[model samples]
Target chain A: MTVDLRRAPAEKAVAWRRSPAGPPRASQKRQTVIRQRQYWGRLFVLPAVVLVSLLIIVPSIQGLYYSFTNWNGRSATWVGLDNYINGIFLSPDFARIALNSVCVVLSVPFGVALSVIVANLLANNLWGRAWFRGIYFLPIALSWVVIGITFAYLLSGRGPINGLLSSVGLGMFSQDWLGGETSALISIILVFNWSYFGINVVLLFTGMTTADASITEAARLDGAHGVKMFFNIVIPQVRRYVELCLILTMAAAITSIFALIYTMTSGGPGVSTTTLEYALYTRSFSLGHFSQGAAFGILLFLISLVFAVVRLRAGVKADDD
Target chain B: MTDRNSTIETDTSNDVPLSATPPRVAPPRSSSAAHRTGGRRVGDRISALFSTGLTRIVLVGLAAGTIAPLVFMVFKSLTKQDGTNAVTFDAWAAVLNGKLPQAGLISLQVSVIAILVILSIATLAAFGFAKLSFTGSQPIMATIIVLMLVPGQTFIITEYFNFSHLGLIGNIPAVGVLYGVTQIPFATFILTNFFRAIPDELVEAAIIDGASYPRVFWSIFLPLARPAMVTVGVLAFIGVWNDLLIALLFLPTPGSRTLSVVMAGAQDTRTFDVSQVMAGSLLSAIPCIIVYVIFQRQIAVGLTAGTGK
Candidate 1:
């Protein structure tokens, strides 16, 4: 390649302002306008681009570098693989938290299935549809802290579930909800479903609207009813939406659950509810182990980056299509 | 019976038709009558009735299950859930005194600052993406979409490092800036779709008329994109208002606490007083609920823009 380095493109010569003779020719002005647009366009986007880099990119790189060190947010020493080893294997709760996160995102299908049902129903020919949708999304609109505290109250030892159980003469079934190891994770998952299912309902219901009524009617005419029609016909047709739902749900699970966990169980009942995200919090802030926390953050970034890239491509492709 | 198609029709009719994420459902208008009364025969009607009945059952059940927590919190906050036989507003009153009010103030302050920053930056960025193609626009936009898609947990620790180094953590405005930056991608995404839907001719006319790019953006497109701007603003408001994890990490001391931080504190130290926590949480949720009830459609439109359509 012949390196002919010019500070400006060839268009710059022609794109400059023409003399004020002959009322400034249209073509020259057009090129100049185009050049102006490009300049302003880049300038307009620059602030945000800089902010994103300053906030996300630089910190991310620093986080990676610090992960290999023994930085405790205050001081530092180079420690090779120590933080990663301690975070993953040596630390008791780290592995469990990792497993817990995997389990949470792994359970995306459960939330999806549940929301799919409600969304389909919402999309159905039912009265009070608006009311139902509003109620469904009520939880979503509320802060995660509010929902977490509310559920924590409900699932607390002497809370409403027990109150209901005892009131119904099923007092024997009443036990510590958040206090129990097994129940803690389950409770978190249930709350997770409760909080997020609304977004999926909205998205999928919107998707369901796009389903061809003619095809559905044709299926109905062919004696395809209920479960068979929905499973074979309706569900498969909304592949794009299902994919979008899964992506959003997974991302929400990993990043947004910190509030819920922090308020609900504090990743407690002996680390049963701790996930990688929560571990990042305690490790960095509570434990003052910035390097380990950064390691966890890097791992989290890698996980999110893969999903993010896939989602980005999908979104771009969908837009292109 | 005919309500099925109406939701789809109504959803878009309520929208800006050229919405970046156009909820362009299949035009079911042509076949609505055919599908509805087509099923009027005895067996089909019966099945239809059965399904509608079934749908009602499921919807009612689902709503009950979903709304139970909210109802429970409200009820318990106003009543006595603790063993002491006293019905009182003390829990609500207690939270209202120093903690809840202060937290609410901090939250409002943070969200206000955050919203301004988000809207200003997102609008400008959206204009670049939608109207003017510049060098690296594609990659920059791709970077934005990727950033938006990823879990924010990835770089929060980095934020922590940055904030700690600058001694800026616990500063509400700094938290606001962070919150605002986090939302730039989504807001820009929603706005870009919104801005692109605007006719190119409009921008061209302004440019040909000698309006500068910024002038055209400010005077022509911004006005056109107001509904979208509102939608993006409402969405940003909700995200920042309800944010907990960021506030939890950044605002540690009670002096700097947002509502969520205060509520989380209640959950931590006052585990026995569930009523107080519930009351505090309910108070914190009021602004969010009010905003949501008022702007649910805009929020939905913003969230599903380009994706849902």
Candidate 2:
């Protein structure tokens, strides 16, 4: 970490003066280098700071400002807290959409827990470990659009599931999974799990990879097997990974799009599947209520921020202890 | 398919028993059976066999759930519903001849532009954050972390008007820029760690050798940062390629749609072309898959290195 700036001539002169080396006036050189380092530091950071400010920092502030105003995608006027009051309290979409988001959030822990269990098994070198790992992690690479299209194809009224059921004389069991108010959100949840479980598996696998295997071995030597070993030995070791995964899952699921809903049900069967993002889109772009959408965005942001802050604090405390 | 198989083969061969020098896994029990004559190793073998069999069945079920949608998409994309019971390639043909190319081009444009902007800004920001001391740096980093938690939907309404004011309304480039910026926090956070991992002595030596900080960065830091840069680039590209909401919002102009946007658009025009959308989705995924396959080890290492801690 030393910064030294001695001109070539000075080095040559010092060399020429009999004694080839005696630190070469370290004090004077250190001063020059420190001053030069300050200049370099400023130069290195200027462009990055400017771009970040322009693109992310300023826009974020603008988002905060716009939450209070009734701007209709054009000119803006101050409306105090009217937008927030109307969007959050008066409008019923906020409650409905918030509930939908909660539904999505509630499903994440189950999905993450399942993924971790499966990952622990795979990490243990059980049957078909490599193939199972690949299969478990494949859906993460697929887009939500693809997930929606595929699920809709399977669950649509005249789709293959019904076709199979009718042919098998189980026609009574067939239902329009993606077409009913009761079924739309459930179908989306299933598709969401299938699409995201791969990522969870990968995260869990990564977590398990770092686990101290000697601990597990000791547990196994003590006659622990399967579920017992997982709960008592492996789980504690991956607590941070599990927590981080939960936070990420909650963040992603909460802001999930109407894409699947847009394609499969279009937030229909009585707007039952309209999550916050979907509702925000519907309000702003579809319904021309800009400030309301901004308000919804703010609420979503605040909720996500709360969870992130909680996770961050937990992470810091974990580090401290 | 052959390429994918080869990559899988490579991963398997390279990853066999990493703890090779000293046997990591315990050897199965054998000699203990002599103490219990009749109740023996035979029972353990039988139980192990039974467990492995049951595990295989469970594994198959897991695979079926994971693979079913993809298989369904492939099947639907290949077959067209012609009248009563007939199947045809009309959908696939339409996808290839028209929608595929259009969607592919749009996605490529968006992904490339998005990656370029994101890499440039993110790499610089990473350097700044990793190397330079500054006032309010910790707060700014906290803000970046907060922004990462805030979903992109939160910024959409504000950005929609902002882009409009910037005269970028209906432009795919504007949408690309937005997607790129949304990903910066992740890229910068990741790359900053990568930057910090570089030996400070290397950079100091370069500085002592009369190189400027910029020169040291370009020569020393950038070269050392290749894996991290690639990781960030790949993730950013994937994010942009898969983005539907941003495109739907800002790039509403006809023919300006990315693959995901166009795939959604296809739902309106015709009966859903499962094969076409699958083909498009698979095709959109190819560039990343290729990069991932070629650099699988680097990717695995880099991602694990960046995110694990």
DockQ top scorer: 1
CA-based DockQ, model 1: 0.39
Off by over 4 Å in 2: A1-25, B1-40, B80-90, B134-139, B270-281, B285-307
lDDT of 1 by residue, A239-263 (tens): 5678778987898888778888988
In model 1, the clashing pairs are B21-B306
CAPRI quality of model 2: acceptable
lDDT of 2 by residue, A62-152 (tens): 7777778888777789888988887666776566666877898899899888888777766766556666766676665566776676667
Mind giving the per-residue lDDT tens digits that candidate 1 earns over B1-309?
Answer: 133344333433454243443233534443445666673557767887888888898888888988888887877788775566477998888777756898899999999999999989989999998898776688989788667754566678777767988999889898898899988888888889888888899988877787889899888888888899889888888888888888878988768988878877777673457677778888888998998899888877765665544
Candidate 1 TM-score to native? 0.87
Interface RMSD in angstroms for candidate 1: 6.7
User: Of the native A-B interface contacts, what share survives in model 2?
Assistant: 0.43
Poorest lDDT segment (10 consecutive residues) of candidate 1 chain A = A1-10
Error of 2 at B128 (Å): 2.5
Alpha carbon lDDT of each predicted model: 0.78, 0.70
> Ten-residue segment with the worst summed lDDT in candidate 1 chain B?
B1-10
What residue runs in model 1 are displaced by over 4 Å at the alpha carbon?
A1-9, A12-24, A221-223, A309-321, B1-48, B81-87, B306-309
